[model samples]
Target chain A: MRIGELARRSGVSVRALRYYEEQSLLDADRTPGGQRDYPDGAVDRVQLIQQLYAAGLSSRTIVELLPCVSTGTATQSMFDRLLTERDRIGVRMDELAQAKAKLDRVIEQVLAAGLTRDGATGSAPVGS
Target chain B: MRIGELARRSGVSVRALRYYEEQSLLDADRTPGGQRDYPDGAVDRVQLIQQLYAAGLSSRTIVELLPCVSTGTATQSMFDRLLTERDRIGVRMDELAQAKAKLDRVIEQVLAAGLTRDGATGSAPVGS
Candidate 1:
């Protein structure tokens, strides 16, 4: 497999793939003629990297955790770190939920007002 | 209130407040020496802007929607847009949940494996 195919299959940009390689979170072999040759595993590897990144793991942390995660093994330190990361994700999820609820209230209020686009305000309920 | 005061109250950077001003998501009056003077309401306005931004609104969309949201009025278009934004946030939350679950599985696996830090693997149940 080549880098472009890996990027396409993983749904990540080639630039990001390169950065992953630089971070040691991903690896590819050099071909005899100086091109990058990725094994089939690279696709899954890139996707995993994305998942960890989305889970709020920094690149350095991902580098540290990848081997243990891939092998289904973890040191006590890694376990502790994973718990902390999980709590952080929970905090972020709560923030997003709060934002969503605020938007929902605004949306509901506007709907009750019965307004219209195109420079027109619909007749809202009259003194109800 | 001055710009710095607004930033302190809103918990956003002075630079971000300026950018919000540039995007018209925020406004302030000019003082005699050209310092920006924000009304007391500006604190709440900036916090609202932060919430909308967290809800994944572009600055332009925030600019368009702020008046209706603040006034508790909404055009039909804005209502539809808000629904879409809410849906997008839902999808993002689902993705975050999935990532957390994946990490949970990994953590559980490692715990069951009973690994330890300091280059030691803890003892696991023998043939259980």
Candidate 2:
């Protein structure tokens, strides 16, 4: 497949596909006339790269780990790094959860005070 | 207290406090000596500002919503904007969760393939 086909199928832009190749995260073969041709597996590989990016892994780190993910026979260092990123994602999720909870509390506090400002502090009963 | 004291109490840097003030997310009175003097409540306000920042609200959005959180009597539009930010945070959390799950699946696939490469594919029994 061509770059456009891969981009269309994988939901990534052509410029991003070119960037992945530049970063050595994706591979394509150049034809005799200088056109790039990609294999069918490039689709899944691009998706995998997208997932790692979404998980906040940098392109350098992704390049390092792509081989392990592609072949599954990498050294312990790569495996450890992958676990570290997974833990980082967990930490981020925890932070987001805390932020959400804080927002919830702020909303609650604002509404409570708003009620007071509206003279409904002591007038309304529960569920009334 | 002065800006440094507020920074210590709030666990935010003096530079960031200044940035918050510049963004109108915080306030301080000037002393005769040209120092920034903050009220005791400034500590809590700084913390609230940090929480909103962690929730991924931009300075612009934070400035727009701070009045409602501060006075509890903002217009309905402001309240609705706050709700919009809350919902955006929720959406971001969901995206992070999905990304994490994808990472987990990739980790599992790598480990499974690593086992196969180690010649343990069909020979290993559970707990053996």
Candidate 3:
């Protein structure tokens, strides 16, 4: 497929796909006309790349991990580095979960306060 | 406390503190000598700001939410906006969690493959 089709299928922008190629996280073949051509599996590859990025892995780390993911032949050091990256992502997930809980608490308090004020004044709740 | 003390206490850098002020996410009073002086609550305020930022709220949204957070006098629009921001954070948290889980699965597969390869060769696991 072309870059546009890949972008649409992967739900990633063309610029980001180009960036992934620049980062060595992705690749594309050139046609006779010198246009980029992606394999059918490019969609899944791009989705995996997006997942790794969302997990907060840098492009460098993603580049390192992608080959190992495909071949399952990582060296000792590569395995250790990938484990460390996984741990970092775990830590980030915990932090984000905590932050979300805090936001939930604040939102509950604000809404409860609004409800109380509305009850006292016998008016519809704000934003209702 | 001065800006330096506030930054130290809040575990934020001086440059970030200055940026917070620039974004109106934080404020400091000017001393007679023109140094920035922060109130005792500034530390807590800065921590809250960091939490909101971690939750992916923009500086503009944080600025709008701060007053209501402190005073509990938000209008209907402000309340709705804040709720929307909170929901956005929730959605982001879900996405990050899914991404983390995907990473976990990949890591497990990689590690398990390494262990099997090591067993077959009767060698210590790679990176062990």
> Which candidate do you rate higher for lDDT, 1 or 3?
1
lDDT of 1: 0.80
Candidate 2 lDDT tens digits, A26-98 = 8799999898899999999998888778767899999987876666544557677778887888887787788
What Cα-based lDDT does every candidate model obtain? 0.80, 0.77, 0.78
Q: TM-score of model 3 relative to the true fold?
A: 0.85
**Chain B TM-score, all predictions listed:** 0.83, 0.81, 0.84
Error of 1 at A8 (Å): 2.9
Can you rank all candidates by TM-score, best first? 3, 1, 2
What is the iRMS for every candidate structure? 2.5, 4.9, 4.7
Q: Give the candidate number with the greatest DockQ.
A: 1
Better of 1 and 3 by TM-score: 3
Residue B86, candidate 2: alpha-carbon lDDT: 83
Output the worst ten-in-a-row residue range by lDDT, candidate 3 chain B.
Answer: B115-124
Candidate 3 falls in which docking quality class? acceptable
Name the regions of candidate 1 deviating beyond 4 angstroms.
A120-128, B119-128
lDDT string for model 3 (A89-109, tens) is: 667667667776776666677
Expressed as tens digits, the lDDT of each residue in A38-106 for candidate 1 is 999888888888887876679998898787778777766777777888777787778789888887888
Given the true complex, what DockQ would model 3 score? 0.39
